[model samples]
Target chain A: DVKVTQSSRYLVKRTGEKVFLECVQDMDHENMFWYRQDPGLGLRLIYFSYDVKMKEKGDIPEGYSVSREKKERFSLILESASTNQTSMYLCASSSVKGGYKEQYFGPGTRLTVT
Target chain B: SQQGEEDPQALSIQEGENATMNCSYKTSINNLQWYRQNSGRGLVHLILIRSNEREKHSGRLRVTLDTSKKSSSLLITASRAADTASYFCATFIIQGAQKLVFGQGTRLTINP
Candidate 1:
């Protein structure tokens, strides 16, 4: 079975602070994504990485950045955390080599920006 | 903007009853998928149906897609309490690495 792991399950940060969320996958997938979930708004993509050192912006990428220095790890960075940024963060990974590749997700991290 | 929209934002049913949810997309898609999230946690993939296919099933779940209308429906037969969760439909576009666009989601509550 494929497994995706997140660095933290819950986090709290003060406003204007820097925050980092990490994700790692053991399946060696080529596609990795970051998403935020909010009530009524559904899930919005923040950023995605297709390969090492490659990144792409999704629907809502403002105030967020991503790093993919290695194939197994992806990091989401919040340069200046704000109260509006408090939400559930999810990480997913997928492979491009197969038919109808499904994404595997991590448990998610609930962040509270004070 | 969201590419897909799910109707009946919330649903309630008793055990052993059938539950159906509808999703409509704005653009052409290569495939559509169903996922379940429990209490704002990570999403678990349930099923995926390609554009060429009309219907697909796994276990007690059935999915149908209509390309002409650009809509899809998911049916859970004899739903159990364990099936209670938030359901989302995601559309996979044909271009740009096939990024998935998700819908607003439907909250399903099943009573025992």
Candidate 2:
């Protein structure tokens, strides 16, 4: 079984503070992604990384950035957390070997920016 | 912008009944996937259907894809209370290293 683990299930931060959410996958997948899910908005991609130190912006990349220093770990950074940034952040990883290899997701990190 | 959108944002059904959710996408896709997420939990991949294929099934779940309409439907047979969760349809577009775009998802409630 594939296991994707997130650094935190719940976190709180003050406005303008820097925040980091970490994700680690045990399956050695080549693709990793960060998304923020909101009611009526669903899961909007923030960033994705296909290889070490490589990153790509998704539809809603503003106010968010990501890092993939190693294959197993992917990090999402908020330069200046704001109340509007509060959301359920999800981490997912997938293998690109076959056509649409399913993505495995980690238990989301619910960040509250106060 | 979200590529896919799910209809009937919320659904309720009896335990023995079947639950169905529909998703529509904006662009061409190589394949479509369905995932289940219990409230505040990680998502679990349920099934995937390629653009060339019309329908696919796994256990009690059935998925159908229509390329012309750029839509898909997921059906859960004999749904149980445990099946209550959010069902999302995701598609892998043919562009830009093939990123997966997810829909808003349908919140399903299976009452016992």
RMSD of each: 1.1, 1.2
lDDT for residue B53 in candidate 1, whole number 0-100: 99
lDDT of each: 0.94, 0.92
- The local distance difference test score of model 2 is 0.92
Candidate 1 per-residue C-alpha lDDT over A1-114 given as tens digits, one digit per residue, 9 for 90 to 100: 989999999999999999999999999899999999988898899999999999999989999999999999999999999999999999999998866657889999999999
Per-residue alpha-carbon lDDT of model 2 for B1-112, expressed as tens digits? 4688998899999999999999999888988999999999989999989889999999999999989998899999999999999999999898765788889899999988
Chain B TM-score, candidate 2?
0.96
Chain A TM-score of prediction number 1: 0.98
Residue pairs clashing in model 2 are: none
Candidate 1: list runs displaced more than 4 Å. B95-97
Span of ten consecutive residues with least summed lDDT in model 2 chain B: B93-102
Q: List the residue pairs that clash in candidate 1.
A: none
Docking class of 1: medium
Tens digit per residue, CA lDDT, model 1, B1-112:
4689998899999999999999999888989999999885799999999999999999999999999999999999999999999999999987665688889999999999
